[model samples]
Each structure stands twice: as C-alpha cells, then as structure tokens.
Target: MAKIRLADALVKILEKEGTKFVFGHPGEQILPFYQALQNSSIKHILTRHEQGAAHAADGYARSSFQPGVCVASAGPGALNLVMGVATAYKDSIPLLVITGDVSSQLKGENVFQDVDINAVFEPITLQSHLVKEPQEGIQLLKMTILTLKTGKTGPIHLNIPRDVLQMEVDQSLLDETVELNLPNDWSNLKPAEKLVENSKKPLILAGAGVLWAHAVDDLHVLAEKHRIPVATTYPARGVLSEDHPLSLGLLGQRGTKAANFAGKNSDLVLAMGCRLSERTLKGLGDVPIIQVNLDEKVLKGSVNIQADVKKFLEKIRKTPPKNTDKWLEQLSKHPKTHKIRTNFKKTPLKPQRAIKEILEGKDDSILVNDAGSHTTWVNLLIKALESPSLIFSGGLGPMGYGVPASVGVSLARPDKKVVVVVGDGGFQMTLQELATITELDLPIVICLINNRSLGIIRQWQELYYGAPFQVELDNPDFVKLANAYHMQAKRVDSPDDILSAVKDALKLNKPVLIEVIVDENEDIPLPE
Candidate 1:
C-alpha cells in the first residue's frame, strides 16, 4: 500500500469538514503543501496578494456560511495574511489559515525566509499552532477547524514546516480525523422564553452570528411571533429583508432614530450574536440585556445564554406568547423620514447624494464598504435591498478588502449586483484589483468617495489630534485609473449626477468606477 504524507492527511481532514475551496498565494516554504494539494479535490484560487487571499476567504466564508480557507508561505507571505486573519478574528468569521513556516530544526535560528509564523498570528488568532511533525499536522488542522466553528467562530492559524509536509505518514493516521461536537445546552431556553414572553417592549438585535448559525428565517419567525422589532449590526446587513415589518434596518449611532429609541426603551434586549460594540450600543444606560452567543465570554454581561442562536430560537418558538399585536404596532409606527439632507459643502455634488442615487432603488444589491471616514455615509444610509447582501471586513477594518472582496463576492453569487464603496485612501490599498474585476467580467460598481485625505484620520485630527500631518493625500484620477484597467469610468461632481451615474453603471452590467469628490473637512458626528 502507498504510504500517505502528512500534507495529504491534512487535506483529507479539511475535505471531511466540507471545505471545497482555498484562497492562497504560492511561495517557496509552502511548495510541499501545494504539491500535496495537487491530487486533492479542493480547488485553489491563486490571489495577487496574501491579503487578497485572506479577504477572498473571508468573503467566501461569509457568502457560503462555511469556514473560509487561506494559505500563505513563510516570511512576507505569512506577514501579509495577518491583517486578514485579524479581520476574520474581529468579525467572528470562521477561517482556517494554513501557513508554511521554516523547518522545526532551523526554527528560531534566523534562516532564509524564516520568521515565526505561529508567533506572528498569536495576537490575532483564537488558537494557533506550529506543527513540528507531519503527524502533528493532522491533529492541529482538525482541531483548528473545530475551534473556529465553536465558541465565537473566528480565525485559526496552523503553521506547517516544510519538512513536516514532506514527511511520510501511515494510513492509520487518517483515523485521527475527528470532528469536535458542539455542546447542546437547552438549559437556558425556559428562562429566555419567559423573558421574551413577559416583556412589554421586546427587541431583537441580530448580528453576523445569526447568519453564521443559519438562523435568519428562524429568528425572523420568532420576532414576528413575539412582535419583536428587529435591528441588525452593520455586518449583518441582510439577515432579514429590510422591507419586512419587523426589520428596523440598522441599529445604533447611524441607525434610524426609531431603531435607536426602540433599543433604548426595550425591556428585553435579545442581543443574539451581536458584540454590543460602541457602534451598536447607542449609549447603554443600564438596559436589561439578554445575550445569546456561542462565545461564553459574551455571556458574562446582563443575562447570559450560552448557546447557538438557532437552538435558543427553536425553544422560544415552542412557547412564544400568543399576543404581540400591541408591541408590533408600536414598532411599526416608528416613523420613516427623508428630511435630513447633509450640507457638507456648497458643491452641488454631495457624496451622500451620489451614494443615494447610485444605490437608490434596487434593494437586492450587495455593498462592499471599505473603511475610512468617507464610508460613514454608507453606514448611516445604506439600506437592505430585495436580495441578500454581504458587508465585509468590519472587524479588521482594513482599507484594501473592498475591491478584492467584491471580486470574491461576485464570484460566489454571480447574479446579484455587487457594489463596492471605498474612500480614496482605502481604494489605493488594492486599486490594482480593478484588473481582477475587469478580467472576471463581474458587474461590480466601484463607487470611490474621493475626499483627498485620509478621512478617518482627519476626523480624528479635528476631534482629537488637533493637528493633521500626513493625513492629506494627492489622489490619482480614478476615472483614468478605471480606463487604464479597461473598465468604464465616470466622475461625478454634482449630487444630481449620482443617480444617473449609478443607473448607467448598473445598466452596463460590467465593471465601472464612479468617483465622487467630496469636501475633505466634512465630519460625520456620532450620536451621543
């Protein structure tokens, strides 16, 4: 019988976990693992950069509800994946990051392309390991996937040595592949059901966890049954159709006034899978908080129900109160308004107006927003469409996730309209990805909010720094950049031009960039 290699065993474990694709870049250290993957059923996507691979994996995981997988070689390759891994960690996205490292014999000896990948990922990964032998690779890979799927479902790192990847392994080692079982704790169901049943003002704040648990429909039914008003975190953009009666759009600082007030007045706050970040907590002035999270650490606050959101909701549905009409009516009448028109500058073209125009009618569109102060408008105004949308990279807050993420998102769900909103500073981080968009023939609308500065840093300078130094930027003409990449391009200077630009771009059904220049000093204030 042909002996199996440790690298082959690791791939077998990943296959058992239902991982079908991996996003990565090839490098010298990981050559052995790549060679091993050659005969495996898993499909690998070669990315332009390590960060792109990580974000692609994140996008894949978010779209498919499976753990996104990424691989990187040693030294610079491993270093590049850190931000993406950190992003996955922050967003609670289950990710399996396989990295190649220097051989154990030469570890800590400063050899060529030798950096401690395990130590590099320790700060970001929920769990990390350095496999010293081929046999250890099988155990570490299996356990890491289980750890990521359990608790909070974040990123895990496994660093494999070159020697270990090439080491011979016995076929019996494949028996070590064990899928960890998630504990079923139905103990809190009765108490949680009673809390939901008895509360006059009940509210449900859903997050990415709901999506991860595949509990969106279940949660929706529970909310409707209990007449609970529902609000989603920014990352959980399309947990439910925004047009639903119970869906109160986004909640928190940029959230609708009614949603914010509802959260404040809610007697029973069923915060499922939400981290209660400052952005979601309008000002938390001692409201009764009931948290249902897989992460045990999150349960220490207010009332903890340490269970998956799906199981908790299943139990609640069986015993939900008969009458929720009064609560539903109150939530329904929370009022809608289009009165607040931002006056950032005298320019007829406003960034907010352009965003509103381009994204106005179609609700099925997916928006990939990049971090920076310029994107504050989307946080405040971007609403859910008819189709399920993906909002990526909230946790790591990396600038470059926008373009490449859209590439992966479009690739995963080809029929949906994928729109990427990025700031000038953020756009530069992965501007080269426009080639990927053009090459893929993806209908991705690139809306560049060009404010000629690091808008977030500038906002900090004005609010806290008091002196802005390197924050200012001399930007490239995005229209020209788009042209260079063989994509349609447009420059919008007037607010009235936004809707038309977006409509045209969408109609083209091809990649296009809409560059909207906004005043640099505009500050989007947070709700106190």
Candidate 2:
C-alpha cells in the first residue's frame, strides 16, 4: 500500500481501466495530472482546443464501444466541452470527462479559473462527482468506470481540486474493484415474441443504443429471421447493411425515402434501443410501437421490454422466423429510394456525386461526417455495413466535429482506415486538429467538400427570405492549410478529378485531405 500522489493514482486508475489515450489540452491547473501521465502507459492526445478534445473522445467512444476519456481545466476549458459532451449524452455515447478545479478551500470564492464544474455538467451526464480528497476521488473514479461499463451508458464527469490531485493517497486503494449489481429477466422476450408473431407488417427501428450495445449482429439476426424491414435512426444508419434487402435505412429529417415510406405504413414498429422521439418517429402516424431498451424512461410503447437490446434480440432469435412477404411486396411496389442527382460529368462538383464516388464500392469503410447539408447527402448515400460505420453527431449536431472525430476514430480503429466526409462550413470548425492527424501519421482520408456557403441555411434563406447573410465563407486555401500542418493535401474541382484524387489519397497510406470544390448553389431540397 505505497503512498503516491492522488494525481499519480488517478493516472494508474485510468491504466487499470484499459484507457489507451486521453484527449485534452493542457492548462496550468491540470498540469499535476498531466505530469502524472508522463511515466504512464496511457497516451495523452493534445487537441488544439478543449472542444476538439471532447469531440475526438466522442468519436473514440462511438467506434470502440468503450468509454472515451477527455480532460480539461476548470472554468472556460471545462465549459468548452459542453457541446461535445451534450452530443455524446444525447446520442448515448459513453464518455468520461475529467476537469481540474480550484482547490477545496477556494470553492465559491471565485478563485482563478474556478467554476462549479459538477453543477454545470449534471444535466448532461449520467452522474457528476466532485472530489474533495485523493482517496475519495480514486473511489469515485472506480465506481464511475463501473457505471460506464454497465447499463444505460452516457457522459459522466469528475471534478478534482488542484490540491486534492497532488495530495498523497494509499496506492492499495487503486486495487479495489467496484462490483456490479446487474439484474436480468428473460420473461419480457415471451411477450415481445408474441407481438412479433401477431403482427404481419412489422418494422424494426434501431437507434444509437444498438451501437452502444454492440448488438448489430443480434439486430440483423432478428430482422433477417422475421423478414422485418429494418430502419435505423440517422446515427445508427449502419446497424444493418444499407444494401440488404431488409434494410430501409434511416428515418428522420435526414431520413431515406424508403425508410420514411416504410415507417409510415408499418402496422407494428419494433423500436429497438431507440427513444421514439419526435424526429425518429417522423411520418409514422399512430403506429403501435414495441420499445426495447435498458432505460425504462424511454419504454413508452404499447409493448415495453426493459432489457439490453442485444439480449432481447438474442432471446427472440431463438424463436421461429416469421414471414411478411405479402407486406414487403406491397411496400416494395412503391418508390422507396431517394431521388438523388447523379451527374458525375458536371464540374463545380455535386456533393452527392463526390460522396458516391468516394464510397460507392467500399461497403466496409468506417465513415464519419459532420453536421451540415453534407450530413443529409452522407446519410442518403452511405451504405453502412454495420453499426458505427456511419458515425456522426445526430442529436446535438455540431459543426467541426468531423476533423477531430477522425483523430479519435483513427486511434481506436488502427486496422480500418477512417473516411471523413465534411463540408467547408463544418470542416473549418475543427481544421486546427490537422496537426494532430499529421503528427500521429494516422490513416485518415479527409474528403473536404468545399462549397462557399452554409448550404442548408443558405438554401432556406434564398427560398424563404430571398436573402443570404452570414452564410458565405471567404475561406483560406485548404490545400496550403493542410500542407502547413505537414500533411499531404489535394484540390480537385471536376467530378472526373474526384476519382483520381480519392485514389491518390487512399494510396498515400498516411493522413491526407482532398478539398473537393462542390457546387455552391446546389439548391438542395428538403427531400423525403
């Protein structure tokens, strides 16, 4: 039971929890914890901004299906993590946030860099704890890891006072394990199976929970067994292979035409690991739902099952398969696919053409896109072979998420190359992280769709108000910007040039960004 600095002990705990990397920017107050990281095995990822750290951690958590870790100092540094944290919580991605605070004696005194970090994070996290002492802080982290590893995972926070982090603590305390009190019941499956058997025209609506549970295969088993059409939420668009016969793709404002059509006409909706929120349930008028989730609060359907999505589906797959051929044949007769522009010959390239050209044949690629009009194009065009293949911030849509998120995704998935599809508006948000990508020499193919305007809002303004304001971007030379970071980059204006650029970028076997000059006046519609 050797005595060590609590800061050192905290780093040890992260090592014990199998944390490979931590995304954060160093500030004076957090230096003690950062000092502890020097002798440790865990790698510290230096993001240019605290927000970039948060988004990068989010991408790590989503792809790895583990609790992504990020750190920040108190006050503004911690405040910057709000957008990324809220996005993870809203999208059900598990994340751990550590913030350095003013010493215990300085609470509420408005000391330098002081803020009530715990109070600020409570609403966005599953739990938020403030540590007064090193010993207690270690215990709290162990317990938090337990929560992160267990049911209903989301964002969680730990606020450590500067004095407490450096204070001495018994090393033996780190050896203590937090036991989980997990409960399970198989009875719910009996009734859920009963519902599946009774409904002739049932549809499965998957959400981000499917990814969190790593239950993509289980979801496929049930969908394929029952011959049920599977429609995922935007973030979970890759839960089932989009090209599969049973796949209906995503349903929402950015939903696929087939998904929206099938959702509206289905007689029974098997809402798996999803919250039947307004956007997810869009166009589904008065359809009876069977909600399956670990959180009881979200189980407001006609048949509610309180269980993990994977386990629930596993139990149901043991039953006999159901045939809905008649219903499927009916829905298939109608137009189920989106009416997208496929003019690859046109210059001032189309976003759709660029996306399709980049991702047309690569079904297994891990794709991440940012929040913008390009999100709609990616959602419509992406044929996600599995969960997390189509990664994005859906609930709290934030720009600049794509570039940094790529950093985390590359770290978590070293075997698979990360393909980033981001627009000029969103790409500029976190373009500073280009240094991180270059320094790591990560295998990330950045497809920066360059349009001079914020296309989505610009479309609305031109249509409704006949005026576009604050949407036009006088952007810098992106190729030079990438080169400044010591990363290879290219600029391709023609659709014909896109294929060559994409091939060259893929062959480089290192971080590369291809700036694709897309049509600024696409005049994209609010499609079905």
Give the lDDT of residue 502 in candidate 1: 82
Question: lDDT (0-100) at residue 281 of candidate 1?
Answer: 78
TM-score, cand. 1 = 0.91
Best by TM-score: 2
Local error of candidate 1 at residue 109 (angstroms): 0.8
Tens digit per residue, CA lDDT, model 1, 367-393: 787888656767666667432474767
After best superposition, candidate 2 residue 163: deviation in angstroms?
1.1
Candidate 2's TM-score reads 0.94
Residue-pair clashes per prediction, in order, are: 6, 0
> What ranges in model 2 sit over 4 Å off?
182-191, 319-322, 361-364
lDDT minimum window of 10 residues, candidate 1: 336-345
* lDDT of every predicted structure (CA atoms): 0.78, 0.83
